[model samples]
Target: MKINRLLNNNVVVVKEGEEEIIVMGSGIAFGKRKNDIISPDKIEKVFVMKDKVEYEKFTQIIDQLPEEHIALAEEIITYAEKVLKTKLHEHVHVALTDHVSFAIERKKQGFQLKNKLLNEIRVLYSAEYEIGLWALQFINDKLEVQLPEDEAGHIALHLHTAKLNTYTMDETVSTTVLVNELIQKIESKLGVKVEEDSISYQRLMTHLNFALRRVSEGKPFDDVDHDMNELVKEKHKSAYNTAVELGHYLLESYEYVLPPSELVYLTLHIQRIQRNNGEEV
Candidate 1:
């Protein structure tokens, strides 16, 4: 490969065939002047060009970005992959670079746009967002391309969703705990003690499972009752009210919004327990 532009001693922009690639490492581009041949061993990542715009944009950015920024970008990308378990897709990289360039320009113009989203971004993405920011700096400094805000928002949302998976798992665990507690409360209040291993408890578990399933499927509570188990009607009114109350409590306490279908199941369980204990409808 031929050196296209030198970002620093350890990093260089290289042209392979018709595409430009950024090569990085401790001594990858060391002592190599422009137009010099680069050893294959020194090459790290070869960013193949997907189109003319990408090539032009990348080349332009490489020309202006400082060496330290380039190194930082590389470090960020590496850290994000290892820590966040996410790969910054190529489109995201391009978008981020553009944003970084704009941020710097805005700063130079005395317009301070505090990227408070950076904190949420870092927390959600672990460290991948940091790498994205570094890449943005490189793009801004080298290519002078300003990234769009919408693109950055989309990238951040994607990272946030990945982080949300953990929360979802926690929600599942909490749902189980809440269901158990509610059952205990009902048994204690009604004086009709049902064994934990009784058929009724098993059936209640089934209803709870269905509720969780509905939530996952995004079904609405009003629409969730069709084709439901007939046994659900035995305590329909109480179940419905209990489900609604529980749903509201969860939303208020943990910001968890249950889908309609799950609400129906929870309501069914609540009603069944209340009716079995001779509670008035």
Candidate 2:
């Protein structure tokens, strides 16, 4: 491929047909100017970025970024993909690299941004959270920087966003925060703690996740069974009431009203939690 430009000695932009691809390797573009042909053997990684803004940002930021930081992000992403068994969005290379670089810089300056959603992320996105924890230790071993566990939560969020591809960072954060809030509400209303690792809790989290997605996508729950809804409401008064409280919270926070069918399923889950806790449901 022909060089379009050089971002750094180890990073270069090359053109293949009409597309611009970022190529990275040690000394890949050393002593080379624009329009130089890159040898196939020198390339270590090739990033074919489709997001225009992210591509521009990646190219613009590389000059300021340490080569090791970029390499570290790639290593973490590779590990995450391997464990998660899914390919993340290419934007992660840019986003995670920028975030980790800034975080390391801030650490040297004696400041670390606190992740408020750390607990929620640990509970809601356990797999990604585990990867994030591994990344923190990997960063420590490679860079000798002891980034706090909160950084793990931030990293997990980035990985989660990339996995979903559809949810932006803001949406992912919002969803996690909302799920945490809903769980707290459930605990408060039912007077029982939902074990984060329990099967019932996982089911509740799964239902809440899809419910939020449905609401955000404007897909109504059209399979409302009035008889079942009324029976559950009557049989499981406390759980049904807690579900109604969660519904109100969703309505107020998200402006999306939960339908009766959703309430019924949600009530069942809550009742199961209560039953698991040895409470009268």
Candidate 3:
């Protein structure tokens, strides 16, 4: 392929047929310039860019990061997709690589940040958490530094964000905190403990997660049934009131306004949890 530009001595942008892509290999562009032909055997990794903006972002990351960091992050992402059986958003390439690079630097400087949502993430997103554990081991094996398991939860959040394409890393963390707070509110208002291992608890967590996603994206539940909503409120007054309070809590705390349909569903889930705990709904 003919070189379009060089990101660094180890990374080059090249053209193949109708597509422009980034290629990385050690010393592949050591003595090369624009329009130079790259040997096929010298290419180690090929990243396909979606547009000019993404191309530029990828180039900037390639220029600034150590080759090993980029390669390790890409390797973890690849393994995650294989195990999870899905294609993640392309933004993961830049986000995860940058995160890994910074994380490595912080560890080298003897700095560490604990992931507070580690338990919630491990329970709520078990699949991604498992992959995170794998990534920690992989990093330890490849880099020879034992990164804390809390980092596994952080990595899992990144994979989950990429899978959903909903929020950035920071937003994801905030959302997780909100969900946990909502659960606590439910327990306090309805006077019921939600056992994490129970199916009822799992359903409640899943529903709240997607409910928040819908609200944040400004997409409310469609085809709302007025009769059912009224029936749910009338039959389960305590649970319905708890849902209403939670809605106000979201609005006041996070500026999230829950729709009427969302409120109905939330009340039903709350009633189910209360009933599962042998408490009056």
Candidate 4:
């Protein structure tokens, strides 16, 4: 291998058999200046590019990344690929690699670091970790090697977030809990029997879904009247207000806040259902 461009004393750009590779570690290019004989033992990783354009792109990427970060990223990619038996997409690999690198740096600086995206990461990539660990054990019995546990934990968190984002709670169970509470407060004001399973209730659920989607997309509520139903306009307005209020309440009481649009949609749904069967709202 010959040096092409040196990123740092610890990191170096090199050519190996007509392939460009980013070598990392303490002694990657040790003792030898540029164009000097490189030691294979000191080299940690060799990132082979597909072509000259990719080589240039990879070089630029390495320049932006810190040395320690590059090392951790390489470690993560190698471990994931070798042990997990799963091929992560480039996008996911890059994201995970960068996150791991930054995390390690933060920890070394005495910063109490927590992977905020840990849950999401776990949900998305736990299978990879499971396979990786199994492979590691198979490679060397009593090797005592371990996969990145913290990183694995984060993957699990993402799964939880995904579930909450996609699934709607049953009206008779979780949804009813919130709906019943709201109905009790508005019963005297509207003066009607609230039915839990009415068609209006379903409509309200649909409305809530719309509002939630808008909120999740970061759209403003003022833009909400685009193609709404005329008959449900007043009901939706009322529901939106209540949903916002309930969202705030949940945030304050349980430190859990749904996005504004989500709350708007959910509240509208509950209100519409409660006012079903000729009930007043």
Candidate 5:
């Protein structure tokens, strides 16, 4: 690969064929000028970014980012990919790099942004939330800056945002609100509180969050299985009844209707939470 631009001694924007990609390695760009061919042995990492906007954002931030911070963001993304089992949007690398770099700067200045949805994030995106918490420790060890729990929530939000490909802060907050309201409506109809820390509750929160996003985007769930829906209604009457009530609430308030399959899954989740032991009620 030929060097297109050098960000630093260890990092360079290189041209491979017709595409520009960021390559990182020790001494990869040292004493190298534009059009210099990089040795394969010196290259350690390459961000094969395909998003044009994401590539631009990366170019803008990378020059200002600390080498350690970039490495940390790369590690976090790799770990998140393994946990999430999905390919992340490329912007996550640049976005997370900016977030972490500025977060450290803010910490040194004694300024921290508060995440009001921390509780909801923990309950709803528990897997991502745990990854966020892990990132705090990783950041602390790698950068020696102790970021607060709020930063963890921010990281978790970034992870969630990456999965969706695009999300605004307002949309995240609105989704949280919808999930909370939907859960309350279901609980009220069922005459029992959904255990907030339970596995079932987390699963429901995750499903509802995605469902709310789909609803907001005007995406209707058309793959409803009528046979399974009738089966759930017959086998889990109370849970299905609770789901129906919640469905009505969504229709009345948000004009969002759950597909029959989603309703069946919701009923199963509700029944799981209601069960005292392995046995069904």
Candidate 6:
């Protein structure tokens, strides 16, 4: 396709059918005027817009920032999508690109922001954290700069935001806060810490992440059978009691009551994990 609009020496915007696509490659747009057909051999990546709002913001960045950072963001997002096995939010193109751009600039000027939540992010979002580390390596290779691991945590948070399918920063923070609060209440009720590194604990983390999001959005698991819930309450009395306590806490604190299905699963998870930790359940 012909170059409809050149973003930079290495990037261009092309019209394919009714949609606009951003094309990237080293020197792909160099010395090529508008409407010049891009050589197929020179095309390295083509990013089709999925969210017009996000695409608008991304194109704004493309029109303003240096091409290298835009390219870096593309590489990182592509690699992350492969490892993550899901399509990230389209805003990642602009957000991550802006982050990498400023990160490089700050690194060159001897400035690095310490990520206080680095440890929590490492344990809670290991997948995204690993992807973040990969991003650091990619940046180092392409930009010839060694970014600190704390930057990985920051990048991980960004990836986490996209993974949650939430566009706002507020949603990301809210989810994290709720997850931490739920775990704290569980540990308090059990009078023991859940093993952060254990596989069972990982399972709990995943469950709570989605659970908290649902509660925050006023959504409840509406189809839980009362009979099955009664069975669990009878069979696993101790864990069931703790789950009821947690359910009560949610109602008291968040004004959202947990459904019976959620309580049953919560009891099962708590019992399994507590038993794994050698606690009496």
Best by lDDT: 2
lDDT tens digits, residue span 1-281, model 2: 88898888888988878888889888898899999999899998887888899888887778778988987888898899999999899889889999988998999899978888787788778899999999989999998999999999999999999984468899988887777778888888887888877888878887887798899888877586778878999999989999998898778877978988999999999999999999998
Candidate 4 lDDT trough over 10 residues, lowest sum: 155-164
RMSD in Å for all candidates:
12.8, 2.4, 3.4, 12.3, 4.5, 3.5
lDDT of 4 by residue, 156-261 (tens): 3222222323322232123224433544554444455554344553354335344444444556664234245333445566655555666666557645547544
**Best candidate per TM-score, number?**
2
Give the per-residue lDDT of model 6 (tens digit) for 1-281.
Answer: 99998878998999988889988899999899999999999999887877889888887898888877888888888898889898887777888889989999999999989886675677778899999999999899987999999999889888878764454766776666677777788888788888777777778777877787787787756566888878888888989988888788878877877788888998999889678878776
User: Candidate 3: worst 10 consecutive residues by lDDT?
Assistant: 164-173
lDDT of 1 by residue, 1-281 (tens): 77888866776777767666767766776777899988887666655546567656655665676544455445544555566675544443344344444555665576655443433333333344554555455555665655443334333443333342233424434555555555665566445776555556667665654555455566655554456744454547555656666677667775668766666655655556666667765
State which candidate, 5 or 6, has the greater TM-score: 6
TM-score of each: 0.41, 0.88, 0.79, 0.39, 0.73, 0.79
Superposition-based RMSD of candidate 2 using all C-alpha atoms, in angstroms: 2.4
Worst 10 residues of 6 by lDDT: 164-173
Q: Write the per-residue lDDT of candidate 5 for residues 196-232, one digit (tens) a residue.
A: 7777778888888887777678787646578877887
lDDT of residue 211 for candidate 2 = 90
Regarding lDDT, does 1 or 6 come out ahead? Answer: 6
Instruction: Judging by lDDT, tell me the better candidate of 3 and 4.
Output: 3
lDDT (tens digit, per residue) of candidate 3 on 1-281: 88898878878888877788878777889999999999888987777877677667877888789988887888898899889898887788887888888888889999999998786787778899999899888988999878888888988988988884457777778778878888888988877778877887778877887888888889857656899989999999988999999999889987999988888989989989888888887
- Alpha carbon lDDT at 210, candidate 1: 50
